[model samples]
Target: MGSHRKPRPSSGPFNGRAVRTVLLAAGAAGVATAVPAHAATGPARAAIVSDSVFSNANRLHHTQTKDSFTVREFGNVRSASVRNQANAASVACSVDDKCRSVALSFQIVTIAGDVHRLKAVNVSDATNKYCDGCQTLAGAYQFVVSTPDPLKLDASARRQLADIERRLDVLTRSTLPATELQTRVDALAGEVNGVLKNAVAKAPKGHDRPDVTLHRRLDGWPGH
Candidate 1:
């Protein structure tokens, strides 16, 4: 008869603790392989904001939630262009509809002759450093070019002059504080210089000639 055979243990000589450690390591490796390496998220971006002012018989308010945008200023804008209508369930985009969105871009010649551009979306703000709302003096005026109608030179010039004067009056009487008025004061000075160099003199004098601005300290930002 053959000698009695001894049964060997199925498990190796490794201790229970070591075996558990190996199993845990393998589980961790499997988890790592299942996850995607590029599944990381980026930092959140800041909200883009601008202080807009406009009127068309009545007034309009709009909002844009695009990543980047563009703009055009001071022209013969129409009311139909601004979709300030009912339920307005769609997005009103800017002049450039590259985003394939509903447009909200509008141009209006104020009674004072100041051409105003209001775009709830798409139109990019004039910035200095890089993107919208990115600089100390960054504004939504990247396309603030004047489209003058030579036929109405005297009329247009007088209107714009009146706008400058009105802006000066409102700014001077603003109560917002000096910080807000500082830039406006600077802007007023620039307007005064520009209107003088260009076409205000040819126009007749009257309320249209808003030359004298009230030098009052106000904090209300100019709506014009």
Candidate 2:
């Protein structure tokens, strides 16, 4: 009878721990591939909210208008354009119909009476979208003033002038009554005139001081 050979033992550097580690790495890669890109991130943000007061007015068909004025002063002549424009925002529109917006504006104009021409120097304007209730919008402004000779004012005077202008701007957007609004306008005009008067007094002899004029107007949709 032939003799049987003994079985040879397996040989290599690989062990049971090494095989388990390879299997675990392959399982992790499979899990990562199954997950979606957005799922790995977070949820999206919500939409922005609008102003409640303005939004409510927009839904209703109510309309409102405030007081306005215009003033022109040159040399020794002072003229004004003032009227009651309470119905300025009134229009024939309902909730289903298209409505008009309200607007307020101020401008400074220089008139070349010799050539019958006019040039607008400074302007401040404000507007609100279609709304039924009484609403006031802040003015977006553009200011450009021309002086015969460049104005040179001390720091204190300049600060006072700036403060007056700020007050005038605040009054423009105010919800005050017609008389009150007119009063504030007149006072503000006086303040501006005071500053100009000082500048004119300090000007050198034989030099003509620049004449400043103020113009204000209110515009809205529909007839008033």
Candidate 3:
């Protein structure tokens, strides 16, 4: 009923940038149907986003579009179960000269609140356009997010870690006046103690864990 649509893009691994662009465009066009996972954390945590979907068929435009997001998580998500899906079907460009499926896009966050732009793991029927008959182009995923034992550190903690590292490097590498060097050493010791102390304080109370593994070299992203 419409002009020949372009052949779908090749199926392959998730291209986060490309998906992100598609999602943004859809959002701008008011096509997106769901918000991201609730990110608020406190005594009252935000509810999980159970499911979201966008399914539309414009016979006038001879196009079909579908998008779904199934996401659930904890404020400090030790584990998560996520599902993302999308399907775009079109015969050919009708009034518009462009044709393509809009895939999934969202960012992943670590336990300590590190934001990472990641495309949902997908099995998609990328482009099935200009076909003899309409067929569904679908993307499916079972995304599981679990904290790796424990996150290394949040952004602020990472900074403190860096400062501690810098001080150690100076203690070992830089040759300074004895008094100044001793002063620096003392400060370094204090910094190290402060970090360890902070960790101890943050440890869960009344919980019995054999030992906590401190990821001294761990780091987190800026935006959560």
Candidate 4:
């Protein structure tokens, strides 16, 4: 008798660059906002202000490969979650060797009372790899206003949120250095904060002023 084994699927060498490009394209097309079910005039009224995804990859010949994934969330979040997926494979020959790697990350953000809380989870695994790392960085901004009505984002606030999403799109498609990308992201966040602050200050009297809290997070990367 002879033993038999199933043949493995044939997938060409993993092209990190191509994978990243496809992911970004899909992510850009998938950006959307979920509106609440009930139309109440209290704190129950909430909506997704902004949701976006980002990714990047690098390959050094047949020596090393690296990939990074990021998810950014903003606005009134009712609940949130994050998941990270990673994999790696290597083949060795007498003359040279080949290696492939991949990383994926997901995140969700939610709002509670006057505070926006974000929780994220990440997982990474590799075969024939020396080391792997994942990190999460989060930022939060709370806008407190004196009003009776539930927090209703005005037109300007919505515009700023849209701008933030656009900036993230640019970041993902850009070939700028890591530091430069960070700078652009930070600047956009600042713009959002400034817009929210102005809204809080100009809020009319008598009505319940809505307090806005902006929660930001970058999941699945080194140094968070």
Best by TM-score: 4
lDDT of candidate model 4 versus the reference: 0.33
lDDT of each: 0.24, 0.31, 0.32, 0.33
Error of 3 at 15 (Å): 11
RMSD (Cα, Å) for all candidates, in order, is 33.4, 35.2, 19.8, 13.3
| TM-score of each predicted structure versus truth | 0.21, 0.37, 0.28, 0.40
The sequence of per-residue lDDT tens digits that candidate 3 reaches over residues 1-224 is 42333343443222221111010111223222233333223222122222322323234544333333222233332222333444344434333343322222122222222223223333333343343343323333332232322223345654664555554444433434323443454455445445534544554433333122211110101010
Residues 103-125 of candidate 2 have per-residue lDDT tens digits of 33332221111111223322222
Off by over 4 Å in 1: 1-153, 200-224
Error of 2 at 60 (Å): 7.2
Could you tell me how far off, in angstroms, the CA of residue 1 lies in candidate 4 after the best superposition? Answer: 44
- Model 4 C-alpha lDDT per residue in residues 100-175, reported as the tens digit of each score: 2222222222222332333343333323322222121211222222233223446766666555655554554454
Ranking by TM-score: 4, 2, 3, 1
Model 3, C-alpha of 165: deviation from truth (Å):
35
Q: Can you list the residue pairs that collide in candidate 3?
A: 3-92, 4-92, 5-92, 8-127
Using lDDT, give the best candidate's number. Answer: 4
Measured on C-alpha atoms, candidate 1 has an lDDT of: 0.24
Per-residue error at 55 for model 1, in Å?
A: 32
